[model samples]
Target: MSKRKKHNLQWIKETLELKEDHNWKSQPGTRIFVAGRGALRFDVPQDWHFEPDTKSFRFLDKKPPNDDCRLEASFNLLPPGEWADFPLVHLLKQVVRDDERNPIEQGEIIRLKRQTARIVWTQFKFIDPQENREAYSRICIGLGSGVQCLITFDYWVDDAERLTPVWDTVMESLVLGLYIRDPRTGLAFPD
Candidate 1:
């Protein structure tokens, strides 16, 4: 058999890499997720596993692959100058739309901004006929440094009341950051 040559594509070369820090295990209260881009960092629980996309970090409350106890979060950095043109209402419309192009039952969109951070929280509820139970979720859009980051919490109606408190605690501890350049020095911040 002849040997085939190895080649790397531009996209493949720039793909993000996920790594678990040994230091996180040794430290008592510090947990961090570092993306290969050096521009993204997340303060995540030490036990959560990185998702395939590298943009999301997932933590399961019980055993593996159980949707009932999953928390999913992802970050997206918008292209330069795109934040100004980004419409929250438009994005929300798309997010809540189902396969039939219908909006799910949702509450009013609440918007808040603090310093450089702008956040939009949307509450949604729908009945999952297959599970014979209601489904609830909170979609959070946090904008900082022109980046829109999403943090979603989903659970069955049965566990909604019990998991409400749990989600609050987790959201409080979650931290997301994007690299910012020092205008004076024109240099990107170190990871």
Candidate 2:
């Protein structure tokens, strides 16, 4: 087993801001493999398919063992000082301002572990007019050193309560690597 790094724990905790009832006791979601370097580990209820190529996890309502949930997460490595160019507040508003998107709730969330960092939270309608399905999405973006991680949890409007917990689990269990691997040498992440 590849050893998980502990140095990023503070950033994870600050971004998550978990609630009281969260299952913090080693709850494993579905195991999804990421090609090339590392893998993402999290536990989703069951029957959810994670497509690594697209970096999307989805389970359709019409499908078998239907979970009626759709979740997607992406990590974008930003250029040095890129985060400063696009502040979290501006990003939050931009999401709701364009494409006729309406936000049910949106704001900046507290970074419990870091006073300097910013995390934005937004809930909006993700409409697919072609499919006639309008899903409710909860997005949280955590700005980190040269990295911007976006975790989106969406489900059919009626299934929000049932599927929200799955999203919560992903947020609580998420662990991203801090180091870049060097095939010629070994592991590298500056201390």
Candidate 3:
């Protein structure tokens, strides 16, 4: 593996505290692989189509009919105290309002559960688009005395029952990475 891949693998292992016997292999698709501590492993389908501009991972389930999901991850580089200017809760509320393409109903926000971690509490939504079809999104923002990080996870499911565990694990792993501090002078990851 190349240095980037090797570094990601090691980072995942150490961050997630994976055991030696844990299976860590690439999944089918564009080789868009993600492995964290424990048995957490997932990949987007190679054949599934998506646009690079969206910076998202798309997948299609072969066994089902028109079943799919798109997951997008991005880092927001804010100045030390900039994040606090816009509260995490307000940021999410504004995103839902600004993006009419995905309107989150008031009931969805009321149903969201707040989860507190070392420096983050997530507000999540799992709404059924129509009978038997579901879509979910979670926005997690971490706060330090002077630093904050935001991570979002979105998934569409034909059945809501299959959504909980996978979504939970993925979001948890992403939050775990927030504990690592960047010492660089750049606002975001150095290109």
Pick the TM-score winner. 1
lDDT of 3 by residue, 1-191 (tens): 00011122211123244445543343332333332111112344455443222322223333223445444333333454443344556665676666433534333332122222223333344454453444555555554333334445445644336544444544434322222122221111212
Cα error, candidate 1, residue 111 (Å): 2.1
Can you give the lDDT of residue 24 in candidate 1?
A: 25
Question: lDDT per model, in order?
Answer: 0.54, 0.51, 0.38
Candidate structures ordered by TM-score, highest first: 1, 2, 3
lDDT of 2 at 128: 47
**lDDT (tens digit, per residue) of candidate 1 on 19-128:** 34312221344354444332334444455443434346555544445436556666776666746446776686577664231325777887766445566767687666
TM-score of each: 0.60, 0.57, 0.43
Candidate 3 segments exceeding 4 Å error: 1-67, 82-86, 102-104, 107-157, 176-191
1-191 per-residue lDDT for model 2 (tens digits): 01112332222112235455543344554443221232233456555554332433343323434445556667765666655546776676666566354454444443312323345666776564545676776776666555566766656777777776776665655544334354223243433
Please say which candidate is ahead in lDDT: 1 or 2: 1
Please give the distance, in angstroms, between residue 108's alpha carbon in candidate 2 and its true position after superposition. 7.6
Which pairs clash inside model 2?
28-43, 29-42, 29-43, 29-44, 30-43, 30-44
